[model samples]
Target: MMNLISNAFLVVRPLEKRNKLIDEYNLIIEGLRSKGINIIELTSKEHLLSTKYLCSGHWISSLGKGVVVVYPMSSLGRQQERNDLVFDLLGRKGFKINDVVDFTEAENEGFFLEGTGSIVLDRLNCVAYVSVSKCSDEELFVEFCEELEFTPVIFRSSYSDGLEVLHTSRILTVTESFSIVASCMVKDKKERKMLSLQLKKSGRDLIYISEQQVENYVTDIKQVKNDKGDSFVVMSKSIFDSLYTDQKNTLGKHGEFLVFDCREIERQGKHSIGSILNDIFS
Candidate 1:
């Protein structure tokens, strides 16, 4: 229950994009390393095929004790080859990965999970909040949840125009003591109430954010602890700035803020700091 991650994976953005992002990337690495987190930098030969947001937490979800589940990207090309390169890199770094589900198989069947992005995991409570989207297949999600013995709290989230939320992590952040959620994004009253009651039942305070806050990446935050058991909440500077004083105060009760400048990363990649840092549970 320490909720401390010993390692994390970060992909080197494409060469053309790295020029503007190297400084921020290094800063993030320095920030995480300072907190006793080992950083695994992924630099592949097939960097071109790497999605702009490939380094995000969405690509892989760790099931603790060195097990991981990698999801297939719906529209991304050469996903298997890219994943092979990544797995090889991880293997060389001494990570004995036991994939619960094969990405290739899922891709062949046109099912995609998008890893942690599609699901907000309350690991301590053994619950997972999943919002159905193109990146998350309902059947695949249920099967994966069953494999891990996690109760799947499935819900639907879409905009007025019927545009689905691409990732659950974008609208919900489940920390140890509390959850930052954009309940407004979930239009269904029953599902919204279900999400609310579930969080409360888990003994977590719900800090609901507006749709505008979600657009500012307010939910893209994560809580982690260092070797000494010092807890910190990691987030982008933009998200930290966007928070109101009361929200900051509420979140501060749980952990100290560990903010970094990732505006370019967010702008170019369309993901926040939470997305870029995938917790390595091994």
Candidate 2:
């Protein structure tokens, strides 16, 4: 599989405190386009409800080819944010609607899986790792794995006080050459080892991050490509600052990178690069 995405899908929905984010949003879009990456902006609906961060487009993910999987979201705001417009736009863009695994109905059963935010997909290796939380349902995860033919690794990740992390990307991130993970995310020693072994078996070098870094949103990143075919990981200045010099060197060995000055965005939306952008076609 060609894992590099040449085109990106970004949503324009603002958070409840969005008056200050318009500039940040435009700069991010301009930066991505400047790198020769195609940008598809999804316009927000007319709903006036206060959505804290529905702009992430977390209710669906493109499963390569024309296949798109609509997920079950915990937030009613996000569920409502998954409008039909994205699908219509994709259809017009010639993305074949091969099949859609509509897990949206699972919300009635109290099971929620918020697309890529609740799970990290190693598409090339066909492996998915989900940190069990209110937003990530194990049964639905199993169903997703079966439909996509992936090995599912489900585990619990929490903070020092036992509050579970809401998003899998907060602690576990998969890049093309390495996996940046928080060992503490897997509370059980044996389970952590098993997860690490699985990644090693799948051929990814491991880079362990500290709990402090995870708390600062360092894992919230994504691997992207430039027009010249060079690979780079997009991150925030906070993510870059949270890392040690040596850790940065090791991560740089995998790919070049771009860091955005997004302190205000993080303060307003509590999200970084990976959270704001989604890829529709590459």
Candidate 3:
């Protein structure tokens, strides 16, 4: 499976030293490597101030196969996050580079579409579930779908704290046979129904999570399979603890839970266990 990730690039907070954060990031990177995933690091040197922009890394890689489509980043800092070095590195590793779509200028001018974060891709079904937010631009989203030949389903979702849902991945995850979505985050009943129906039609059993659990980031979990094909759900210990007994059981039925403490990284508000890891395929 091809996973997506950006390099550990961030604008250090004005008063905070970045060295420690870099170290923590390296540790997270190491954890991902141990799992046998290929890492694709974006080395762009531009600097932008939005977490949403880092998601462009998702576009730089193929979702499940080796097809590449690059997205433009709206944040100036993020434009700097892309690195030719990273692309060269991936190319050398055997990941085919099919096409590169540059949307950087449009994004810089205000057009936005925050890669995987804004759109939760059901690769097996060729569907992209998106929540319209500041980071998710409808026109650009449709354009992306058209470019990639993906079917786009757009809706509005919000976090318990009333923050516009920045990333679809933060509220929904799809495995081979099941999907976990924080239904509370999705405000529109009709849209939710459409999303659920799409998943059902695609052969994915639906699992719903609550808003409170999502607040703790429990919904931002990643499902991975080891060499033996044994599945495991990787998440932070905080998220694991936030799950109810039933939710835990539901996930356990699909895979073993692998939880790591991320209190330090969480403080930065920039790192997610998923983003920290590199995609093995480049």
Best candidate according to lDDT: 2
CA RMSD of each candidate after superposition: 2.5, 2.2, 4.4
Task: Predict model 3's lDDT versus the native.
Answer: 0.63
Superior by TM-score: candidate 1 or candidate 2: 2
Measured by TM-score, the strongest candidate is 2
Q: Indicate the worst ten consecutive residues by lDDT in candidate 2.
A: 48-57
lDDT of 3 by residue, 94-129 (tens): 666665666556675687765656677777767888
TM-score per candidate: 0.89, 0.92, 0.81
lDDT of each: 0.75, 0.76, 0.63
Select the stronger candidate by TM-score from 2 and 3.
2
Q: What lDDT does model 2 reach? A: 0.76
Candidate 2 lDDT by residue in tens digits, 1-282: 635453556556454346567667777777877887656766776663534354444787886776788888786766777777877877777677788879888999899998888888887878899988899988889999998888899888888888898888888888777788897767888888887888778677778888888877888767777667777778888989888988788778766777887776688667777777776753
Off by over 4 Å in 2: 1-6, 13-17, 47-57
Candidate 2 residue pairs in clash (backbone atoms < 3 Å): none
* Cα lDDT tens digits for candidate 1, 1-282: 423344555454444456667677877888788888666777634445544554545666566666777777776553532444666767777777875554547877899887878877888878888999888889888987887788899998876577999788878988777799888889999999998889888888779898878888888787777767777888898999889999899889888889989887788777777776677666
TM-score ranking of the models: 2, 1, 3
